[model samples]
Target: LLTVIVTAAGLVSSELRSGSAALTLAKPISRAAFVVGKLSAYLLHLLAATVLGTALCVGATAILFGAAPLGDLLQAVALWLVYVLLLTCFIVLLSCTLRSQLGVAALGIATFIALSALSLLQPLAQTPVGMADVVTAAMAGTAFSATWPLVTSAALALVLLATALLVFQRKEI
Candidate 1:
């Protein structure tokens, strides 16, 4: 998440601020093409880094602990990748509107925290309470019992990315 936000969220804004956007636009590439190309490159970079990092961590843990849960680790990493992709979409979208990478990063972190907190609603509601909590807890637990936070995050990410693409298309270079 930090890597995606730091490196990708500033892709367009940084270029524009540096006056390189105009030069790039002067080329035959359309704005949509540019956005797609840059986003693709960033995603590819993310994939490579994530794979390498996961491999290193797994190897280190196996060597050091001798009891690494490789399957569980892979599952966790896959779920985490979903999160990274979602966050990347958000950061890219924010970059379209925000001029400063710092601002985007701050907002991105805050957004992540807020979204993550949604998962707690279930556990928090489940906490024992004096009678009034019983109904609330039941409701909260049932609401998400059939759903996963990752799915929710993915949906939100897709929406954010689509909105960002629309906004970026209309935004002034």
Candidate 2:
């Protein structure tokens, strides 16, 4: 993701801002194909990072922590991949909308902050109820609070990615 922002946003935006879209057009490529090629390159770049990161994480778990139960480990990893796809979709959508490094950085930070807040909301809300009260109540009824935030986040990401694809296809640049 960082590499893409550095290479694509910085490098690509420089070309767009300087009216170099014509240079790309001179290659006898359709505008849609050109932009799609750029997006696909960045997509591949992110895929490399994610694949390497996952491998390193699993390797570290085995080397440093020792191999544990494979079932739970795989389950955790599968869940993580779902969230990662959600994130990648969001980043790609934002890249289409802003096409600027700074804009992408700001949006990424804001999205992370918002998601973190949502994830932490239960504890934050229960603070006023006292820890003991929360624990007692949680033990009595349910251990989990609202899961709507996660559902919403996933839905929003899918919607945004779909919208971005449409917008990017029609975009003149």
Candidate 3:
């Protein structure tokens, strides 16, 4: 979240706040391309960081524990990637509307927590049943069900990005 906020939203917000946006626009770059390019760069950075962080964590765990949980690690990595992508698009969208980095960061955090809580509703709804029931249900939830969070995150991210692009296209530099 911090990675996406600082890299994507922070950079753009700072550029806009410092009046460099006008200078950059004075060149021939279209606003769409500029926003997309900035987002792409941040995503690339995020991808590299995620891969490197995962490698180091797995490597360290293997060295200390003799074996690493590759399956669980991969699952976690997939979820985290979806989360980061979703948040990155969200920050970009928020940054366009909110001039303050602090405001964007605060809203991003709130958005993440809200979305996460919503996602956990499925498990919580079944909680009154018992722990065993929850675990069993989760296990039996099917592959798609198990990966529902990732799918939802991806969908939301796409929507947010599309909206951001539309807003950015009409926004004055």
Candidate 4:
């Protein structure tokens, strides 16, 4: 969560601060394309890091514990990836709306904490904020369905990305 917030907090604010966004916007490319390109690049970076980290952790666990449950670990990691992706979209949206990178990061962290706290409620247990519990259940090899969390997280991510694009488009740079 910190990684997502820190990385995305500077995605646009830094560009705008350095005057790079103005220069880029001066080009023929559309603002939407620029925002999407930034998001795509970050997503690729996040995916690669997640894959490499997971592989190393799994390898180490297998060596230490002798053949752990790969299915359960992978399932938990998949759910985690979905949650992180949603977080990235949200932080990106914050970056678009806020000029200060620090402000974006602070707000992102606050929001993450708030949602985590809210997840303790039974009613919100099925939301994306409760993804940590679902991930824990998966890792523990408990029987639980991850369908709703995955679907909701993905849907929220799309909404966030679209809203970010809209905000960036109208932004004065």
lDDT of 4 by residue, 17-128 (tens): 8899999989999998998899899989988998999999999998999998999989898888888888988998999998999999999999889878887897877778
TM-score of each: 0.77, 0.58, 0.80, 0.96
Among the numbered candidates, top TM-score falls to 4
Better of 1 and 4 by TM-score: 4
Ranked by lDDT, the better of candidates 1 and 3 is 3
Question: lDDT tens digits, residues 1-173, model 2?
Answer: 24433444433344455667668767878755655566667666766776787688779888999985555444444444445445555665666666576776567657655654554456443222122223233334535332443454467656866776676666667
Instruction: Identify the candidate with maximal lDDT.
Output: 4
List CA RMSD, all candidates. Answer: 7.5, 7.7, 5.5, 1.1
Off by over 4 Å in 2: 1-15, 18-22, 25-40, 122-155
Looking at model 3, residue 1 earns an lDDT score of 58
Of models 2 and 3, which has the larger TM-score? Answer: 3
Clashes of each: 0, 0, 0, 0
Q: Comparing 3 and 4 by lDDT, which wins?
A: 4
Residue by residue across 54-173, what tens digits does model 1's lDDT show? 899988988988876566556556656666777777887888787787888888888766655553565533221111223233334432221244556567777877787787778877
lDDT of 3 by residue, 127-150 (tens): 221222222343344233334444
Better of 3 and 4 by TM-score: 4
Assess each prediction's global lDDT (C-alpha) against the native. 0.67, 0.55, 0.67, 0.88
Off by over 4 Å in 3: 123-144
Q: lDDT of model 1 at residue 141?
A: 41
- As for lDDT, the candidate ahead, 1 or 2, is 1
